[model samples]
Target chain A: MREMIITNNPLVVEKYSERVLFIDGSVEQVLIKVRDMVHRKHGLISHPLPASLRVLFSPYRSVIIGRNNGDINPLQVEIVENSILKYKKHMDVREVDKENNEDYQMIDLTLLESALKDEQVNSMLSGY
Target chain B: MKLEIGRIHIKDIQFGDSTFVEDGVLTVDKAGLIASLKEDERIKDVQVDIARPGEKVRIIPVKDVIEPRVKVEGTGAGFPGVTSKTTQCGQGRTHVLYGAAVVTVGDIVGFQEGVIDMWGEGAKWTPFSKTYNVTVDIQVVEGLEVHTHEETVRLAGLRAAEFIGQAGKEVEPDEVLTYELGGMFEETAKYPNLPKVLYVEMMITQGLLHDTYIYGVNAQTILPSVMHPNEELDNAVISGNCVAACDKITTYQHQNNSVILDLYAQHGKELNFTGVIMVPEHTTLSGKLRVADYTVKLAKMLGADGVIVSEEGYGNPDSDLLMICKKLEDAKIKTVLITDECAGRDGLSQPLADTAAEAVAVVSTGNVSHVVTLPPAEKVIGNPESIAVLAGGWKGAVLEDGTMMCELNAVIGATSEIGYHNVTCRLY
Candidate 1:
């Protein structure tokens, strides 16, 4: 079985080799920042990504994320991977400051961005 | 978007010398309607009949139900991009022949079509039982593919409705209800203190016999998109599928979507009703993920604080319903989901095929597999024995005395997820 982890922080995407992670933004601020960046990357206008987004996780395509709560369905994971490959594109980026742990780590949306570009994840976001 | 629906309450329908409405009574030129519908060569024969609210009548193997409406002052006609003509809808004046519906019956296609009982114990379950139904008994060419057969009956119903809708054109309506929602941003500015909410309506788009149409286009071919709730009120979206009969939203329900209206009722007082976002319930895993994801994306784009998601059909579509709820709730957007259950006859099974911890507020429309018994109708409109082959019926569903026993699945709109009916379930 693929490994799984559930957390409120997006940095966990790179910290573990978990195949699936459920990011619960049970807190309002954590939830809003997570949503804003995901929408922005998809070409939708929203609040600017916090300055914290700049400090950690560069070379940012390291992990995939989704906006759903609880454990992800196995079938959904497979389809999301396929959709990611279909819409995959590359952009310039920098490496993460793994040692930095400030307001930066709390709202970084790189993981959610990776999830938004993921095939199944994209479908979950775009198809409906 | 804004619209004025002029309701001309229909009290009775009868065969007459011409088609027109007089003093709440609708008169149809039966021979003329049959002749017009027979224009389609695929149709072998056509018979028009009427079933009223208290009549001892049963219309079986039903395919679709449509309300007779005519766009009196709009860009498009009745059922824009559908039976009439293609044009934008949900504006101006449209006349409605309320309390009456055009019910299509006759030949069976798949095991998905249902029964409409006009009287007796069965009448209490189906919303169609309360309508003054003008049923068309159709006979398609023998050996026709199920696809062509469904199309034949579907078009027949639309044509008949368009024909009947003409009767209300020149008459004055009994009551007029107006629905107006300014631009989304404008509404937000007007009701700045209230929360903004959107509605995500998932349609069944599995295949030929399982589909929905928006302005004459199959929902399966389109991606998730936005629609003014008024467009639906103006007959823009229509039911073209023959899934299980109990929960399918007939065209009438689409024209009179209670969820949209209820939200509109509280638009300024309690909330700001942002428009609607439509998505299809696709059959494949990838399709499901794509639509579910996009649906949330649209809701987020619209800046919704709360949303109500309603699903069509059951089983697989439950995955899409829960997925939307999960994404929205995870994003901290409150959501309420409406769907029916297949909790088995004993009601012990899980209510949905998939579930998420975030899907905490769900409205159960009722169990489709729940069985019911109906005494034989004093007069049957179509085929009585068809119940045996329906989705929830067995080979011996019809008793020797002509009484029938079947699950709620065979009854049309018994558990409408749109909140059209009063039927619901509670744990015993």
Candidate 2:
């Protein structure tokens, strides 16, 4: 199944032009789009939150969402909504740091690529 | 597999002409080590400094901490896969420069680098304070990409430790501890009446700076796999993190994993120590579900009656932790979990990002958002102003008088989820 790459990371946008939904904003913006998509019944292909809560300080973010079937995935909705809560919880206390956009963009791009590797495993495990 | 660790107690470190250990002190060949590390063209410059216990020294924006060790009687490398050839470890004797650490410091590649105060109120929060630290402050060549820069420092620290670990190969250790775990069937039969306990170690595999490597393979690329405890003890797992400082397990911690140590202590006496199933915490819901199911399945396959699960990093991994816990409990397996919380500044918010009714027994290492004030250090090793951008820090956190205020989130090993540090929580 094809996946949607929702990101504020330019590296991701440049690499995955076809499926990338470029968000020209903060990390929260990319996540919000994922939540909105999930609410509209898209399944969460990748986790919205980065590996570390600290990465929340970085400006760049990338999350993957899979295509929706006819019905909504309760679990996908729950994970994405909870992911927003977790991000807001951390951000509520500390707003994203002042700078380091380049470094963060690189980090976010790396994480996005890491999540993309799950596709291979998914394909491998689907044998009848 | 069985491993015998010989500890050469290192009380202090000093820069000298040659690198070797003698009479509780480690003399480092600073120039030689730096030259060896600089062989990697990515690193432009490397500076070596020492921070011992009770010093007024503070190493900041630190990346990774590795304990130096060398295999005296083993056929493989000290850190297989990443730093050396992929050969089986834990089959012979290894020497450790105990009470010492290779502290990697540099400019922040990500907001997750941490601080280690060698003395004063700050030292109390970090386990690195007690160890004689050999700080490797790396400067990557200008124009190098951030991701490659992070990797440069990571590999440099490993090479530095491998170089320093050579000192232990010839020294007579003050203490020799043995770690041995036999075949699963044999061990289970040997302690047939004991409760079978498995260890589920959740590794962060989000990306470059937020991943753990097992025998050189990224946890992100592998499934939940069974590992002999001895392999980890003999320097198989290495840390690659730039995400969270307080709770992220360093390579040093992996080499001296408290969970593995405790389980081995009670391997045959109190419980049947089955083995370790190293699991990766993923970013996608599908990935998380797949991993959680695989982890529980591996535990069941081992026929575990009880299990100890330790989480690395927090927030997103929180969901993975609970999912695995819920599944394990649903399997009728008694599961006890260890983790840290981000309960806001006043400790008022919920501890984890996700929760479950099945998570009945959980240990809170400490709160990530709990703020602390660290007094000024006479000597600050790395960048002092970098705190403002750290995970647990904020704007104006440096303060006017040099006294810094931040959450435990910025302190190294303050809230180690593996029970390696001094964060205590009790419920009455």
Candidate 3:
């Protein structure tokens, strides 16, 4: 059997005893016990817990959870991978041409900053 | 010496009773005693060869003395003509008379004769006492000579239209045109020391005019009207009859001291000659580029002579100086570099201190025909007279009270066969 707990307070670490602890299944039973212990000791639950967390830890126990359950969903990861692939493809094309290869090199950012501040830079840049 | 009846003398001389002898000489003791001798009965020629033991020797005459007559003559240039006359008496004596005349002092005149009265109721002739008459004269002469030159040329400031009117009146193609630059003339008038801006306006209404060859330094603007004048002189500055139009431009490094380079560049299309642009060494790169652009564009459009870069910093490095020259050359413009090390304490540096030998070197290396530098007022030495002669003549002639004779000579000598261009004079 596994248990899960969720609380608004970050200083509830001593009750868990173990530094690295993971909980799975029977989230409802664990929340009820934690709530009862907090009520008996503190007299009241000052801050409200998240409604989503309450629902997941309600009387409904033995729920089936998916592997992808965190904030980073599958759709976000796919989008990030597509952007990296596109950048690599662009770099590969630029590297194939000798004329375009120079453009791929990184410019000295400090030189660009100084050039922007110079009054005559705009005139010279326009000339180029 | 003579012995008359009124005059007394001892030892075969005439004497009056009142005229006593002292040391064997006749002496006059009474004023009126000489009147007795005039009566012919008192005494005449009373001779005495000797004096008694108790008598005196020297004799004094009892008569008033008469002043001797003198004669004078006049000579030299500018003397008037005159005459003389004489009258004779029975005793081989003649009276001389002189006519009115002018003579200088120390002049000699002939003593013609001596005269006694031979006419009159009681006129008589006696042995005449010798007397001479001399004539005196006075004359005047010039002390100093002063020479001056005037009535040569007449110059007047006129509007563009006036010059056009005069140009219309010209029947010949080679006739000279004249007009004045108004603002320059006005500014020059305000400053007491600056040179006068004499503007010559040329009217190019009809003929095909070569701007450079037609209007030298004196020519400035054009006019729409032949009479009513406009003060917009700068816009009217067209290239006169010369291959190039150039002026010395001085730029300072201090803020707010920028020169209006556009004023010169505006007429770039009209100028056929190069612009000799000068820049101070310490001027910023931005300022140098502006000058360089102005010069390069004008030179490209017109024909740039060259760029002369001068460093006013006394201790500026030669490498930096060479770099400026190199930059100008890289721009495809000819470059001449002047170092400030030779500027000296007299405030003149660079080309001014360049000797003839150094000037030759600059000409050869820089490939420039003309060089500009300050007048050597600091190094100049000698008396002003010698300098004046060396300068070929005085830059200006002034009267004691500081009156300028430049205009006078210009007006007077303008029409003469000989022309005076740069001579200046002052008159009080």
Candidate 4:
């Protein structure tokens, strides 16, 4: 299955290279791209929202989305759409805390690395 | 499984020539503890500090808080797999240093570390503020990666708890509580007319700093597994995640899980407590579907008529919680969810990211995004500047005059989904 990482974190772009869809803006910008692509049948491989609410205020984000040739998955579209709204609602509390954005960027990359870890193990198990 | 828990009430903690408990006061050899904890090559320095209730003390960037306990009649002692030999727990006589806690403090490893204030306004928000705290300030080797740094501090807290747990081994508990539940079939036969209830605990099992350990195994690597309630009581699980401190299940909360204790309080009288299903909140959608399906399957296997599901973190986990709730209710298993709402600061935002018509009975454990103002502390442990990077804290969070302002998101145990903290909403 072909997948791509849509991220604003430079660390992810530097590590993943070819599979990266680097976004040069904030986390919401990355999710905007994701919602647009999922509308075109690019299904989400990872959940759109960050695991915790605190990181929802982070400036960086990385989402793994699988490129699908079939019709849009309603569940995927709903998740993406709901997540964008959720992030915005949370942003009502305050803007992204970018003062320590380097930490946020690293944390975002770690979450991306976490999603890629299972893929690496699966690939090794398949002996590819 | 049946286990007896003995509690030795500790009134205060103070440094002394040696570590021991006398007349409810826990005397610790600060130098000795620092020496033992400093044995780890990853740790450069360790400090032993005491923060009692009503003191003007603040501990920030806290990693994990653990209760000191010793197993006198069990096979697995000292957290079993993580800090000791891999052995089954929950079937033994465990003694708890009831009011005392070992709090690990260090440099900021992630954006989710939290604060515990021991006096005045801050004390009311966090449950840890009331405990007689023995703070372990650990300074790890410089330039260590964040992942290793988290583990290094996590292990230190466990080790310190184990060391202090030894004090309880020789002392008599003020009271002993017994938790005994027979096999599923035996319990069903015993209470044929009662409804079977299951508790499904969801742990954030994403990558890096988000993880939970069961008997030393990473929970994310395994399918949703059914565990005996006693296993949880005996230290079978521990938190290794940095999921926002407000709702993160600290190791102390796991040792004395409020959900498990409340269910046990009604184990036989009302509902036949079936068991627990430790569910992992994965970051992938497929993983969510698979685990939710498996959780429902387990609840059905237990013949659960009702189940209480509690979430660990928020946002992405709202989907996981409702997915599991939807699956269980679809199976005709009445479901109730326990979660903290991120209703934003004004409490106007929708409580959860995802919802299900089946989730009609959700219990809100306060709102994580509720902003709070705390007065300045006379003594601050760890770096106060750490508040700037906290999930609930902004750059100017540490105001002049030593005052602090943050969301319940950064306050430890403020909005615990497990009903462990003091935050509650009373209709006026």
Candidate 5:
């Protein structure tokens, strides 16, 4: 799990399990992890991610999630790589109105990892 | 499996002493056909007529359009399970009246029935206008349940098509086309470098007014599964839906699915066309989730590198399309979606009820809400007043001078999601 994520939101890191960690650096090193899992054996098994999680990852140019300090979860790397491959064309995020109380925020990569884990547990519970 | 399609190109249709095809002309015994339809106790009356291309004829409240086909050498004769005994189709020889169709018109079942004009501005929108249509105007027994009325009309159309297709049995086809696909491993070995593409076809399977049938079973009761693409070509899939006319895939479109034909043209040369996945568009959220999840799982299992998904009815089914796209993209399979738009009259509203960033490659058929004006035909086939209450039409749709104004939604096959027609949209 060799990756670095840039985000100031601590809630993002809080969502992940204790085994996951966010290092304060760049995730350029995780590119190797993605290349390694590109040839993994294909399987019929699939775990459905939450709709909210899909929306969370919809607009990112890239996403990276690693394990404690610099080790990447091979499965997570594959997920992020697939997301980037499906990208058609990116558009600028809509600007929020000054009068509105809400605004867009950078997606937390750790939450995506946590959602994947939640899906796995749910799939197992349902005997998938 | 391999099947040879023998197309008897019918140039025109006329009522005559007996039913037969002579020199490309289809002469039908109108009284005899109508009498056969009356055999069903639920059907009170049946009026048969013909509408040819370039005729000033209008067929309103159209229910379904069926292409007449009969298997001459295959295990099945007509639409298996529905019109014939349960047997496999898509094998052996079948004869079709290529340029003809059986169009059913009746009282409105849902607000989704459509209008077909033979010659007018409206004729340009519907594919049925070009076909030599044998109109079956049916009247169900009074107080019949809504579902019974729909089923009665649906079966009658199939019966008429089956009856008419008999004339083509003894005639020679002007042209013949054969379609065959080998086993998975065989195809893979033949086209090792090409992408393995599959078609995930979603049919509207919700209860009344939104149903598609496979082998005479309502798709609503079936789970997501695989289907031989040729089976669909051999009248395996039947449109029982009464959705907004412009986008619904009629039985004729299903039999001559353009996407399947286009993909077959590219088969072996560009890609190894895998097969079809029949998925039902369920009404419940849980059912949607389950079906979508299963669909992608099957695609991945089949080693699909690319998949094309087509939707039937709109609204809730859009969610199923997006969900399937999300799952397929997540599995690293490229997906292309074909659908129609409900973008408002002004075209400012969101095109689909649901959207996903994963559905980046989409082919929009057309906007169903775009209003168009059609000068009334000199002869109206069905009830014209039914337009006021139809889905895409309002009370004043029929104007003072016998002209009618309505949305594209009321025209049959105007926005076929199966890529049967050429109508599309562009952002302003």
Candidate 6:
């Protein structure tokens, strides 16, 4: 498996993008070799595309571990894409006022992402 | 596998290899299944088969079974319109607060569920964003008030009478009569001569009492005690004092004095006259003709200024003049007999200028102070420049050329002034 890093908030990833992996805290050592399997399907991304194809390659979190008959590939692509589209259309990100705070901060998008993830899990469990 | 509970059917269930217990109930997925039985009269006897993993299957009566089916329903929320006191920063935009996802007009959908793979005009599939058409339900109620024609007419009559009465004087008989007839004629113009006769009679009566003790007399003798008397005052004393005190003493003092004396002696103190007894010729119609006696009586009771009787046709040939005179006499009202006798006896010929002079002479000789004459075609007929002349001529006046005539003398004298000289004519 390969690892990809996203530095900005709400980062966008192109289809079939390649990146190098690191072991532990070492930046030059290769822990494993991997690439996006669905990259060859689409050409260069001139315009913004659905988020379903992009991967949120987080270095902190581990991949979901499960051995179920249903494949996560379809769910991940569709669910992520739907969430991203909804977020963009509604312009969900906004500066929120907080009590006892000096600076205005962007609303947490992580909660919304978690909610979408929960919904996906529920849908799968409900035989959808 | 087959599963049944209380005569209901539970279908397509498979038992898993493992079993788990939760909340005092054993739960197993894909452990047992049952198909619903169709309603049939012939299938009276039926059996169910139950099977469990690693257990021998058992057969049971089909009376107990349960069936299950997936039923899907979804609800969501979207923004509709704004509901805040603060002014919105954006232009041409409305903020909507929605409790649940609603299919309404101008809604921005944030969530959706169920049947996601469908696309149509109503589906939210386009990247352009979905538009929800909403409608609000409301109910309206209305009421109306209506009035009848008779009520309207009665009200109009009352209003007119009220206005006239407020002027603070009795309207002349001819004037009152003309107005009543006019009122009636407004609704129906069939009776042409009625208003004229009433107007003429009003003028004559008004003129007659100019110098005498009579004052505030109405046109149609609406009040019996005042204009119409039930009894005659025979041998009544003629007070020379009242007659001598007249403001405009005509040179014909002897004649005027004798007439005044005769009126007093014959009628007495309670003397009342009716109809148009002294009216100038060419007056068009006998003003005294009463068409609706009841209406007149009613009007009088209602305190109307006067009443009018209309004649149907051209001349006094069918004149009810005599009848009206008698009625006024019976009622003891001062009556002025009006007739449409244009001088020459022939209806087509031009009216005689002396007709008024003659009528005045006759009235004077008959001991009557009141007599009005309508002028002849060219002499008394109204010309644009002479309208004021005609109007002002009502009072017995010596014109610029020294010709004396009475114009609206009847109305002015009857209402405001005293004596025929003070009365002025108003052309209708």
> Could you estimate the TM-score for every candidate?
0.76, 0.95, 0.18, 0.96, 0.76, 0.16
lDDT of predicted model 2: 0.85
User: Proportion of native contacts found in each model?
Assistant: 0.00, 0.72, 0.00, 0.68, 0.00, 0.00
User: Ignoring the other chain, what TM-score does chain B have in each prediction?
Assistant: 0.96, 0.97, 0.20, 0.97, 0.96, 0.18
Query: For residues B262-304, could you state the per-residue lDDT of candidate 6 as single tens digits?
Result: 3333321232212222121111111222222432353344332
Question: How high is the lDDT of residue A70 in model 6?
Answer: 40
Candidate 4 accuracy as TM-score: 0.96
Clashing pairs in 5: A1-A70, A1-A71, A1-A72, A2-A70, A2-A71, A2-A72
Please provide, for model 4 over B1-428, each residue's C-alpha lDDT reduced to its tens digit, 9 standing for 90 to 100: 88999999999888888889999989888888888888899999888788999999889888889999999996888898889999888887999999999998886544555889898887999999889999998888999988888889989999999888898889989999999999999998998999999999999888777889999888979899999999988888988876588999998899889999999999778999999999998888877888999999988877899999999998788999999999999999999999999887788878899878899999999988787888877898888667666533445766787666778888899999999999877988
- The 0-to-1 C-alpha lDDT of every candidate, in the order given, reads 0.71, 0.85, 0.20, 0.86, 0.73, 0.20
Expressed as tens digits, the lDDT of each residue in A1-128 for candidate 2 is: 46788888888888889988999987788888988998887877777776566776667778888777667888777777787887888887676764677777777777777777776578568741
Q: Write the per-residue lDDT of candidate 3 for residues B218-292, one digit (tens) a residue.
A: 111221111101111111122111000011010000100111122222222332111222222211123223433
Q: Candidate 1: list runs displaced more than 4 Å.
A: A1-128, B108-110, B391-398, B424-428
Give the TM-score of chain A, superposed on the true chain A, for all candidates in the order listed: 0.22, 0.88, 0.21, 0.89, 0.31, 0.26
Chain B of candidate 2 versus the native chain B: what TM-score? Answer: 0.97
lDDT of 4 at B79: 91
- Name the weakest run of 10 consecutive residues (lDDT summed) in model 5 chain B: B386-395
lDDT of 4 by residue, A1-128 (tens): 47899988888888888989999987889999999999988878888898787678778889998867589898888889999999887775576776767788788888777777765655476575
lDDT of 1: 0.71
Candidate 1 chain B, poorest ten consecutive residues by summed lDDT = B387-396
Error of 6 at B47 (Å): 99
Judged by DockQ cut-offs, the docking class of candidate 2 is medium
Q: Between candidates 5 and 6, name the one with more favorable TM-score.
A: 5
Identify the candidate with maximal TM-score.
4
lDDT of 5 at B244: 51
DockQ of each two-chain model: 0.02, 0.63, 0.00, 0.63, 0.02, 0.00
Best by lDDT: 4
Instruction: After superposing candidate 5 on the true structure, give the runs of residues whose Cα lies further than 4 Å from its correct spot.
Output: A1-128, B108-112, B390-398, B422-428
Candidate 2 vs candidate 6: which has greater DockQ?
Answer: 2
